[model samples]
Target chain A: DAGITQSPRHKVTETGTPVTLRCHQTENHRYMYWYRQDPGHGLRLIHYSYGVKDTDKGEVSDGYSVSRSKTEDFLLTLESATSSQTSVYFCAIREAGAYEQYFGPGTRLTVT
Target chain B: AQTVTQSQPEMSVQEAETVTLSCTYDTSESDYYLFWYKQPPSRQMILVIRQEAYKQQNATENRFSVNFQKAAKSFSLKISDSQLGDAAMYFCAYRSYTNAGKSTFGDGTTLTVKP
Candidate 1:
């Protein structure tokens, strides 16, 4: 509903293989974030971007990396996928001076 | 880092009735934001309501309202006229205005609406 789109809605990859999930926003929001949702743990931040070429690590950024080369695109990559990395990844965006964030449909990733 | 807590792991409510979900947070900062996100079977994280720390008045969105006790660091969500579709996992989240946009979320409370 926030003009946010996440690519590869579902993904399956082998362990040790690299996987990348893409989050694109059409609204050109100033901030974008990636989060992973698990069973007991609600949602943990992975990485975020405040602007083009500006990125920062989140709480659960150990196994993930993010890039924001453009204003409308943010990419999250896992260099070596693992079973523990399987999760439902979400992309969220917040407008300037806004206190709330809008989330996109999530992507379910499985690492076998 | 700010932390959000939802002690109720699960709760049940009758259809057309009302239910309240409790959420507490810890933060040293004076200004921040609290949010309630609903995740249904579709797995989409929907923003149900939010409250600004600086504002004394609570925030409401249609049937969803928040009882924000700034002094107690408590933010509870009240759902009126609960429908079957309201059965979902409700998460409490906190974000610091001075920090990065990263939000800390509670484990979540699974709400079940009984007909």
Candidate 2:
């Protein structure tokens, strides 16, 4: 698809349950990022990966963990989902050190 | 660390007219990049325009152009002959050199096209 795909486009989960969102990219880009969009706050970076096994946290990384085991896949895990975690999650990919990015369609997660 | 700021929370423009969305950023590095992304109702983020800090010339894509004022640390998007399809949320973003490149996004401006 020459694009990024986010799995489970829409999800409904109960609080205290673990949820994982997967981001797969056919572009094989070295830089991958996860961001959450909330009302008023816009998009805030949760985590990002520069390469396989090279990941770092962004401004709002609490309660979220990410792993980049391969260049094509970046996984975001919510150890225990909460109502406040309900938001649209976006996955983005770009070449190393490039500003231009291609984003996935986004995943809408709801915690009840 | 770099920060991107989009001042206009919402804006309205008539079809076939022009509208400008304002943005400003803060960074200490000399080399960086700025970008604008559009998110439609589908929630798909698409790249609108991009500019490299080293380049003095503004980057333009069709009717979409950026007013890059490096001295003022300002980057504004101007859409000319706006179309109904242009109605969406426009996000201004900034990326700077760190151990790895990390992008910071603005609050975004919702542009409404009134026909």
Clashing pairs in 1: none
Candidate 2 pairs with clashing backbones? none
Best candidate according to lDDT? 1
Judged by DockQ cut-offs, the docking class of candidate 2 is medium
Residue ranges of candidate 1 with Cα displaced over 4 Å:
none
- CA lDDT scores, all candidates in order: 0.92, 0.91
Chain B TM-scores across candidates: 0.97, 0.97
Q: Candidate 1: lDDT over CA atoms?
A: 0.92
Model 1 is docked with a DockQ of 0.85
Error of 1 at A85 (Å): 0.3
Worst 10 residues of 2 chain B by lDDT: B94-103
Scored against the true structure, residue A91 in model 1 reaches a CA lDDT of 93
